[model samples]
Every structure is written in C-alpha cells, then in structure tokens.
Target: MTPPETQGQGSNAATPGASPAVSLCVSTLQHRPDFLRAASALRQGTGGFLLQARDRRDDSPATRVGFTASKKIGNAVARNRAKRRLREIARAVLPGMARPGWDYVLVAKPGVTTIRDFALLLADLQGALARIHKP
Candidate 1:
C-alpha cells in the first residue's frame, strides 16, 4: 500500500505566490534584575496569577517572559507544577498579545495556579495582559 500525500509537507512542494506564515519571536527572561524591574512596572492581577510587565525601551524586538512560583504556593513539587502551568499559558497566549521589547512575569498564586481550570487560566492571562497594556 502507498502512503497518502500531505499538503505543505516537503520543501519541494512550494506553492506559487504564497507567503509563509510569520511567527512572533519570544525569549525567556533571566537574571534577578529583569524580574525586579518588571515587578516595579505595570501589574494586573487575575484569579489564576499575577502579571507584571515592563517596557525595556531598547532596540531589541523580542518579547521576554518569566515564570516564578514561591514557597507560598507549596512544596517543591507544587511549586514546580504551578510554574509549569504558568509557562504553558504564557506559551499559548503571549505569542498573540505580547509586545516586542517588553518583559513580562507570571507570578503563581497559592492554592490557585495549580488547581485552576486550564481554560480559565488562559482567559485570566489574556485579561491580565490586556489590562496591563491598556493606557
């Protein structure tokens, strides 16, 4: 039996006059100062977590994001789980709404971040982002 052919699978199957999809560039924020600076900037709280954002005002054009879960969230395992959820939500939502040259931090809430519904967490992140970006 022959394998079925798929569209846009190989480089040789290029379509005429078609533009490739563009993906937003994003990077992870490291260093304590970056997180502190964002913490002191705009803040928006949602049911799932706290969102902090700051504009770097530099020439770089990539959005940076950081996730943090403190002891208040729980022990090591719980903290890790909370951070993982934050990272997933950021991955799903940040690409569409995050602004270039801005740094964002997602702070996990105790007893909330890990147990909240995934869809609601996503909505919370989206709402928080919208609030922080609003003038």
Candidate 2:
C-alpha cells in the first residue's frame, strides 16, 4: 500500500524509497509526560472506534503496542536488550500487516524484549496486532 501523508516527524510510516519497514511502532506514543496527550490524540484520530469483533478497538486508525521492564530484568544492559527486542518486533511485524493508522508503544520491561527469540518476538507482535486490526 501507498504511504500516508507526512505530518512532520510525526509521520513515521514506512518511507516510499526505503526498504519496507515499520517506520515506527506505537506511533501515537511520546515521552512519558506526553502519554495522556498521545492517548487522547490516538483515541480521537482513530475515531474512538474499535474494529475487532472481539471489540478490541479494531477499527482504530492505529494499533497500540506497549513495553515496560522492571529493575529485576537487570542493569542498563538488560534494559537495552528489552528495548532492542521491542524494536525488532516492531520492525518485522508492523509494515505489511498493520492497518493504515496505528500507535505502537514499546515500553521497557527491564530486559525482556532483548532476550526473546527474533521469530517469536515478531510472531507475538503480529498476534497482538491481528487481535485489534480489521478482519
């Protein structure tokens, strides 16, 4: 599919000339201070509607993915791993399967995402998105 209009840096969809990739996952998220604002924007932009027959906000323009890792995961190294894992999942799963608009947030869970298998991480992301995107 064609890329969406660019609205500045906020426009993080896959670039046309570049190889296919999820420009950014959890598109609607911002710094923690902006979480409420981001959520509000996503809620409105996606039309306050959900698409999944499971009623999981499936019709929404952007699907949201969150990540959060606690201290037990390890020190900074571990945390980074978690973030990397989340990013990889975002990279692999979001480009083709996602609906037109989606907000994918990768919260850090100490060091979770970093340690997971690449294929499994990707599959997990797909499962999450599929549950919410349209049929």
Cα-based TM-score, every candidate: 0.82, 0.51
Predict model 2's lDDT versus the native.
0.50
Clash counts for all predictions:
0, 27
Residues 8-127 of candidate 2 have per-residue lDDT tens digits of 544575555866554543353446644433344422111111112112344655555444455776787776677666656666666677655444454443333555567766666666
lDDT of each: 0.91, 0.50
RMSD of 2: 13.6
Which stretches in model 1 have alpha-carbon errors above 4 Å? 1-23
Residue ranges of candidate 2 with Cα displaced over 4 Å: 1-28, 33-67, 108-112
Where's the lowest-lDDT run of ten residues in candidate 1?
14-23
